[model samples]
Target: MTALMKQNIRRITTVLVSSAMSAFATVQTVGNFSVLSMNTAGLPDFLQGNDVPGDKTENHRMIGAKFVEYGYDIINVQELEFKLNLGQDFNYHAALYSTASLPYRTPTSGGVPFGSGLNTLSRYSFTDTTRVKWNDCSNFGGADCLTPKGFTLVRVLLSSSPEGYAYVDVYNIHADAGVTNADLVARASNLRQLSEYIDNWSAGNAVIIAGDTNSRYTRVRDEIRILTRENGMTDPWVELIRDGVDPTEETICANPTTLSYCETVDKMFYRSSPVLNLQAIGWSYESSRFLQPNGDILSDHNPIVATFSWSLPASLRQSELYGGPHDTWFSDTGVLSRIFSPRISTIRFRGGSRLDAVSVAHVDGTSITHGGTGGRASELKLTDGETWTEAKLCLGQRNNRTGVFAIKARTSAGRTLTAGSSTEDCAEFVAPGGWGIVGFVGGSGSEIDKLGFLFAPH
Candidate 1:
């Protein structure tokens, strides 16, 4: 071929590559990360390796190597404790930490017979790290009370997202073992304690909880629903692997390694934040990856890995949706429904004993109303330079039905509007620093059943 023809072909290839790159860039808002949760079976060397194969310290070294090899972004490990006078250069903690590629790690909570045997290793920096001991434990089940088995929390800073800095609260828990009645009660209490702590501390934040739960979804009286139902967490295994169905007692597998439906005690749960949306993209038991050179397993329990895809909305950040179930859902961020103006000019509440409806008017002369039109209407208007800053909503029972009983809206300029009856069962939604409320999202029919806030950077 002629030199001119060859040059033309090269130009065509360049254009095609550029077009593909541009298409990829348009969808760069979504980011992905992976987490691995394992019960390392790191009992003391004298405990005969807790019935798991291989030397305790050596197995830890291999586990760390495998973690790095698999490129897990975060690792939550249970039963990884250090022991004194083991006559080795390093204990289990040092063996794993020194070998893993993850730069940030929490020190072992304590050693065997005393510590919580929980640790977290991550590639991202973390803060507000805390460990809480279980308030209830039963000696009838597996000596759970002997060690301070509970949960650990770390606020991980994910700086690598497309939109810059994001924070996620990560938790690692190890509940009471055994199936005795006392064991079940103590495990239930453990889950309740964690749920309360999450509601208090991690509210409105992205969260991921994983580790050896010592409880099963199929097991009666497990109380695992507290985390999912009460806290709005999603189990990745159930969602991705089990097709959104929990296994029954008859379907429980004795050897999860050989089965596709593996529901083990080692589990992972996650929820999204207002600013960040997280979805489980993949789930795996990871049994083959943790095998020893001799083809034996690394631990008595297989490690579970979950891959998550996260994205940030173009401009709006949402607060947690609150209140009761409704027939329909609405969000101000919808393409055809979003408020065109950056500032909310007016908020009108219609209610008396219970909230009936809400209407928001924007500076651009566009307005949207939701809920039933049965109650008295009250409006709060914002002057120039004024911004909506917060909302307080109370949920209560009215006419034998549960719904929003009170609604209050406050502006940065000290203006306030309140409607309906006041109650103690309330939640406050406030904009984060450098952010302001832009709009609202909720469900409404004859009455406003649920409510949430929308935020944008000021």
Candidate 2:
């Protein structure tokens, strides 16, 4: 095994010992810099007036270069014919695509013959996967209305660090953008079914379901929100919009107006227990004026990119100190982190030696420290709460190693008779992976047994 692997094995041993002792620990860091893009809109048949009818390989290279510029790790592409060679040029270790056959039409001069489907690319390794296909092509009528075959699901292991194994599910789809409403509903149902499948297999796994749903209408976006959000999933784009993300033009349809860049048709969505930080989101619509002797643009749909940072619970430390689940759990399609109370007393932590550091969650009046852990600790404190409240543990570097440890609770007034810091009394519960929070309540005669530790790592 490699050095990292050896360290992982050693940590597992420590975790076993720590669980015997108490438990606890997280990032898909946004600053890592990543992007996802697509829309070569290639079709099987040829046509006369269609100058560049979107070639799958050309689109792939263009999107890949865009990602390279922005330092993106993942790319979701749509309208790929599956015939393009990705053997070495793309350089993705784990890639997934669907062969959803579509009717062959006339091809544009010098363009690809024709094909249909979606594809996903990743630089990281992938494990535990599934593929889903849809049948909405029937919605289109007559010889001109060609229905698409379906979609695909590819699940990847996000982290197998000393802390735990987390996952992310990516789905690539090219829904019939020609129709709306019921057709969109059918596609949404199909996606939901896939989500349910993942839920059954990996309960607490992070998921990213994206594609060219062709649901550019307001209703379709709403339906998507319901399918994911109602099921505990969060849309990374919507989250970015909430965080104030700006949009860029990737494709421009030539019209008399010359100002026809419209619709957020292509997209990428994610849902999970961890707080997914919306790092960057934008479309690829740079001008082609510099590329040709006579300015010419390629492709119809501009590829879209979305970057995320995973923020899971801190319960792993507690689990290590006390013992946590070897498997995972999910609320629906999203993973579930251990719940922590604003008020804390006991900290069931994992690996920690005299050389390692540990910090406690502190509460000051109305503020909370989220349990900061690093270096040595004399006593863990939270911003004082007149009312019993819960907070999180902020553990730093020593995070990945240290097992669970214990923390004694006392009033700022120096009264120790009130609370007992023990996972046994606190009803210790493990967070799905290894991050979570402890719950504490305050009263004249408060029950301190409910007080536990909530830890989140990096």
TM-score per model over all chains? 0.66, 0.49
Query: What is the per-residue lDDT of model 2 for residues 376-416, given as tens digits with 9 covering 90 to 100?
Result: 43543333432212232221122343222333333333432
- Best model number under lDDT: 1
TM-score of 2: 0.49
RMSD of each: 13.0, 15.2
Each model's lDDT: 0.80, 0.40
| lDDT digits (tens) for residues 1-458 of candidate 1 | 99999999999999998777656644554778899999988777565456677777889999999999989999999988756565743368888876886899997766756678899999888865789999999989687887899999987766532222356789999999889999999999999999998876675567999999988988868798899988999999899888898778535444228675856888899998655789999998888888889888888887889999888655666665668754455556543134443666788989988898888777777677888888899998888888888889999975666678899988888789999888999988877545667766666788888887777766
The stretch of ten residues in a row with the least summed lDDT in candidate 2 is: 441-450
Query: Evaluated with TM-score, which candidate comes out highest?
Result: 1
